[model samples]
Target: MNKSRNWPVAVIVLLAIGLAGMAYQHFKFGEERKDFERRWNLTAAQLHNLSIVSDVPSDINFIPAKEGSGYVQLSGKLKSEIVRKLSQTEPASDGLQLDLSSDSFSIFSFDFRSTKSQITVALPEGLELGRFQLDLKSGGGSVRGVRAGQADLKTSSGRLVVSDVKAAQINLHSSSGKITAEQLEGTLTAATSSGGMSLTRISGDGTYTLSSGHLNGTGITGHVAIQTSSGDVTLSQFSGSGQIASSSGSITLSGQRSDSLNITARSGNVKLSKDDAFRGIYNLRTSSGSIHAPDSPGQTHDVIEVRTRSGNITIR
Candidate 1:
């Protein structure tokens, strides 16, 4: 009977030890979480360019500052160790470079599952940025209300959104991600692989190249070039010259006025729509498909050439 009583006591002791251990772990995790929840503020001299490199899931925002001042406001949850390391890094002469990757946490050996962290930056309005570039390996983000001389945004595999941007030169590249931009001005160059691209209300010379993705845009006023393979191309309300080429995908173009229109396709259909004010010489050709031209070739100064290997051509 005494031995039986001892067994009960031992079991009770073991239960208590397990409860204590669980409580300790819980408390430690809570403390670590609190550390990550803290916000960090940093100020620098007049910045002309900005570069950000992150390899984790993050959200970044660029807000136009109401007050005309050069300042960076960073707020988000990150590893305490990462915050510590960032505090030690020095900013470049022209801007700041942040590399927030798992490699950054290699120096710390604390055994804990890392939580997702995000860092957001807000810039002052009318700051006159010379260059704004972002290189993200994974995750998604957005940029808004940016006014710069040049901007370049690149991502490996995530959705990217940009709006209300006025730049002299804009370059966007994505390996496998969707890109959407609106109210963009100046010269724009966009390239994507296996991801769709959408541009709206653009007023500048633009060039878009895509492989296995769709390209769609509207309200364009300038020269434009589009090249795609296995993806469809569509444009509406275009008021300039355009050259489009595709393979295994259809092309649709509706223009207000165009001085020169050239389209080539392989195994895909080509469709064109124009206003009544359009007067151009039509040169339509197809191998294994029907051809529909708006008008016969004449002495008109403007030219619309359409060529297809195994697809139909329709013009109206």
Candidate 2:
């Protein structure tokens, strides 16, 4: 009996068994993946069945249903190949509804990239819900709503329009786009990089930061700060204490009065004007820029430091 012949037979048997096991595993994985994809596609299709009217005004209305807590979220994207189908309204699915409470709070978000898509949210005459959150995003989606208690809105390169937002905590961000908000109350923080920001009135405490753009606010209360790299920083009526800094642009604080006022720039003018008298530790410094404190009659307990590498400092 040759042992070599028995060795060859055993090797052949092992190879056959390995091939069979691999084939079984490959088929099983493929089936599971296919099933998962099918279910996901089905769920998306159902969500697309929801109402998605182009010309219809974008609005989210919520009435105190259970009175314990409630949530509303709206999110969408511009018409792009990557997000085209995802933005479409689908029928409700088991995963579509993210109900926080058994019958209290709900969250809804979608995507829309159509040329003519707009969203607006309004609270009915009398509705005092607890802990409400809303998020709206689009390539060209305009979001207008009255928010209260923690509201956040962001856009990549679209127009953002918000009005009458009264939240305990509010945050808004936009990238390379335009943002307009009015009558914002509570702790608010709005920012835009390489875009424009215009706010009517800000009552409470907040900060606005910009990379290379403009930030114009009508009224700001409490502590506020505005920073820009290479753009204008203008505040019509700013009260309380805050700091405004810019690199190579003018910072005009018109009719501004703060307990602790601080303005610094690398190569731009710092204009601080006050209608009446103010009292605080004022700190104004600029290099290659001017500081004009004409009507600002306050006790500068800190120091009126002005230094310019290549520009003049003017204190009026």
Candidate 3:
């Protein structure tokens, strides 16, 4: 029994030695990695305009910082030294500039196959900026409880999310990413190419456009104009009127009131609530699909005009 135990101990020691040797070789080849982080503070009241541009795929988050304690925090774990050096914040005379580009080469700018960074921009709590802008090549950006005079947030192929944001004029654009916003007030303009949109409790005049994704919203109280191509438009609790158009998708709306609404669809269905309590002339027409409505078309000031090619029209 003693001899057997000695052999087992020897085998264990040998295995441990082999593992140590492999780890040593791997480390000796410079395969080690180190993360880089930077944090700084600035006066929020001194700055008004903010611009952030990133070329890599990064998660950019904005939060309300402490009073008079605004800061910009950037961190990344990258292999290239140039990328680590380029990721920094510069305080300008009027505002601040943040560039989070890993590779300075503009040829493969949007190729997000290499490194990703996380950025945190902490603004002063309850301090609104004069203007806000973020242009990301291939990343996602999110913010909550922030106010700006005008905000223009765009991403080439990533998501944009905002909550409880109040801006006088807001523009959100995404090429191949989704846009999700809630509790927004003022003039809003949103567009997406292949990504959808989800909005809730928005109180403003808005214009939305989508290429091949869905547009869904609720509790909207504004004169809104919506257009989509090969995507669906679904809204509820809407209390304003403008126009809604779709090419090859459905339009479903449940509203409390409307002044004058115009809806046009190429080959999709239209559904509305019969209990909308609006005395309007519903000019509903379709080429082949059926129509179920509570009122017929007549000359009136309040006109709910609906036209489709080959889809059912239901106002019940």
Candidate 4:
């Protein structure tokens, strides 16, 4: 009888161990699911209407001109502090195209304002393909894939990114945070107070200005202008005549051929290098740094005038 009672107790103990093991596995599974949702949360505010374009036209994509006008506004103020999750999704692989090349249309206008929640905005494919506008006011937000004829972007303390844009005029200004653009065309103007600006594969005639941050560009043509109070300026393969100024940093121009080049620095060095000779009047000055430019080994015709307060000028 004692052995029989002991048997019952042993069975009870084994059952308890199994229950504990199952509970541990359940806890771990829940934790993994939580992490998976966190990284894939890409949410935004988007607008699409059928009335704007009764039938998604093949030749003419986007909204018709006479259809109408509308706006997208986001309040972003939440009532309760609930932990809501989000999941991100990407577009399908099969892309659409336009059959007719002669016709173009302006799709929509986006106006975004945010208060509390963070936002990421995505645009439709090749929209406007011509004329578009974006007006953003918020504590913080991000934008991607925007095209327009004329664009005006201003942010107080938020980050902005614009890519693959074809426009006649583009304007961007930000107080703090970084701005980067790639494959941008036409006349462009960008300004930032405490943030850096970087451009790559840019093709157009444009002007750029910056303060308290770095300004960098590659593969840029046309008239260019850059000024920085306390940052470095770097340009590569920059063609056309332009002016560059820096209050307290180095200025470097490489693989550059220009008609006229002017460089001024309060206390920094200036370096210019070119494989071929360029015809122009060069004015370079520095308060307490050296200026160096090696002349072409072959025949050349150019005028270089340099002045320094307490620095040396070296021409090779």
Q: Which window of 10 residues has the lowest lDDT sum in candidate 1?
A: 33-42
Q: What is the Cα-based lDDT of residue 282 in candidate 2?
A: 36
Which structure among the candidates has the greatest TM-score? 1
Whole-model lDDT values for every prediction = 0.74, 0.54, 0.79, 0.53
What candidate 2 gets wrong by more than 4 Å, as runs, is: 1-115, 118-137, 280-284, 289-316
Give residue 105's lDDT in candidate 3 (0 to 100). Answer: 46
Q: Which lDDT value does model 3 have at 107?
A: 42
Best by lDDT: 3
Clashes of each: 2, 21, 0, 0
| Residue-wise C-alpha lDDT for candidate 4, range 32-59, written one tens digit per residue | 1111111111111222211111111111
lDDT of 4 at 170: 76
User: What TM-score fits each model?
Assistant: 0.79, 0.59, 0.78, 0.56
Predicted candidate 3 versus true structure: per-residue lDDT over 60-99, tens digit per residue: 6667786558876777654454345545445776677776
Model 4 shows how many backbone clashes? Answer: 0
Best-to-worst TM-score order:
1, 3, 2, 4
| lDDT of candidate 3 at residue 191, scale 0 to 100 | 95
The residue pairs that clash in candidate 4, if any, are none
